[model samples]
Target: SGCDTQTVVNNNGSTEYGLFQINNKIWCRDNHIPHSRDICGISCDKFLDDDLTDDIMCVKKILDNV
Candidate 1:
């Protein structure tokens, strides 16, 4: 997927970003999401950049939590 790729998963404004499709509702912060969580402690927009390092780290964090 493109670095800036994003998809709205539901009508409630829940969105996923980048190659991993990290969700703003739980993994990252997004202003558009009224009740978003930053469990990965990252801005959702960071996942939209070309750098995949942070994205991978966030994924690892998610997996650890799981």
Candidate 2:
């Protein structure tokens, strides 16, 4: 499916830019920001502590829905 639109998120009032939306019970894209910045939360890595910051990549998110 193609992306509709994007929304920016200021994580904890920081410069973390992320795109996402919660609609129809679905949490859409996040930050749409460059992978170099912001930690995306699309998946749960039970193996990790999930202390990822906003400046990280949520590669799991992309893979999960794809």
Which model scores highest in TM-score?
A: 1
Per-model lDDT: 0.83, 0.30
**Candidate 1, residues 1-66: lDDT per residue as tens digits?**
454456547676688888889999999987877677789988888887778999999999999988
* Model 2: residue 48 alpha-carbon error in angstroms: 21
Summarize candidate 2's per-residue lDDT along 1-66 as a digit string, tens digits. 023223223453222223322221122223342332222334222113324342134435445656
Kindly give the stretch of ten consecutive residues in candidate 1 with the minimal lDDT sum.
1-10
Candidate 1 regions exceeding 4 Å error are: 1-4
- Per-model TM-score, in order, reads 0.80, 0.18
- lDDT of the structure predicted as candidate 2: 0.30
- Steric overlap count per candidate: 0, 9
